[model samples]
Target: MDRSAEFGRWKAQSLSKADLSRKGSVDEDAVEVVELLNSREEFFTTSSCAGRILLLDGSTEGSGVQKQHCCWLLVTHKPCARDDVMAALKGATSEAVLKFEPFILHVQCRTLQDAQTLHSVAIDSGFRNSGITVGKRGKTMLAVRSTHGLEVPLTHKGKLMVTEEYIEFLLTIANQKMEENKRRIGRFYNYLQHALKRETISNSHSKIKERNNPLCTHKNRRSQGKAQGPSTTEDNGRELEDGDGLEISAALFLGDD
Candidate 1:
């Protein structure tokens, strides 16, 4: 049989007995069976539910479903084995629902240090800190902190004056960032330690080699003059000598500093 026909047959056998009632009493063993069916590659398709009844039994997939709903029934009394069953059901045919799960983090901070820590956390979680700005005006200098493209208005006391939902979203984003920061810091510290150890070993070997070499002296050498004519004198009566002990004529020029 062709691939499509084979897939349809497999889906038919798997979901043949699925119940569509939200309150139907599912057999305990059927839960595992349903979970397996949902996890199969063919289960996330229009063909999979063609004859099967949805748990909500609505005319359409998302008619009565709430936004951001979780654990709602897709197939009646069927086990939801997939990680994102609701999302899969919404976009089973179009493949768009899978992309709707947004990246989120949770952040918490009251002081600059806390803010910095949160920022680091964001970085560790594979996100940029971006920045923080004043969320709302208060009587004092305190204001609500906004980060990661989320804005939470502040009250007169500098506390967040937004809905609980908004605050939760912000915190979630911050937390993800914090976790990312931790991983990055760990990797950086490991690299730094390895570099320091390598440098220390190289320096130690160089020092040992220098100590063993007798010609590696620390004193500075003085220039020797060669044999020549009589030495010349400057205005200060200081004698100037040549390379071979001969006196040399010289002049000095000074500029104001």
Candidate 2:
């Protein structure tokens, strides 16, 4: 199949699934990126999160060791307030933790080549931990992610380890991390768009070059002659049967298997 036809088939497959990022509870900052990816023929966003700050109640092991139960006390996609964090900490019976997670985005690609293109762009845009994997039924999935995260223990055995002033300081740091995460998201979108624009321009130049070059024309004519079943060499090259030449040219142009 030709590139256009293959792309059309892939697009139809992608449009069959609902984009979950459209739900109301999804992070507001990530909505635009999801929409951009869906608009492209090569990509479809499956699932995504815009990161969050959370309070957790878990247990502490020996020095510098703790096993979190992944329980959340309070979760916010945006920056949380000092009053909010303090209020959540008051009722902590075990160990308390304040965590900040960076943004994450998952995209399904039409091919492995497409997935690699996106992976390269993600890394250039500061998503250092981004990766590609083949999921169910051989679908190529691209995960856009960053390593900006924080996990700090706030209390132990129902007692506060840090002072109120220190809690405020930690909240300041978490807010800074939230801002950095948003910046990285913006970078990802900008870089991807720029790369796509370059590819389009490059493809245009390739087509123009292919049309103007005489060697390519001669080579195509030779292939057509062979398809026509033993044609004699002519002044330009070799004359080919009418229908056979067109068929041969199309197959060669499309790289059909």
Question: Residue by residue across 125-207, what tens digits does model 2's lDDT show?
Answer: 66877888996656688998887999999888868899889989998999999998998888777767765564455456555
Model 2 whole-model lDDT (C-alpha atoms)? 0.72
Worst lDDT run of 10 residues, candidate 1, spans 220-229
Q: Could you give candidate 1's per-residue lDDT for residues 65-132 as a string of tens digits?
A: 56433332343222122333333344333211111111222222223322332333223223333233
Off by over 4 Å in 2: 1-24, 59-69, 204-257
Which ranges of candidate 1 are over 4 A from the true structure?
A: 1-153, 158-160, 214-257
Q: Report model 1's TM-score to 2 decimal places.
A: 0.25
- How many clashing pairs in candidate 2? 0
lDDT of each: 0.31, 0.72
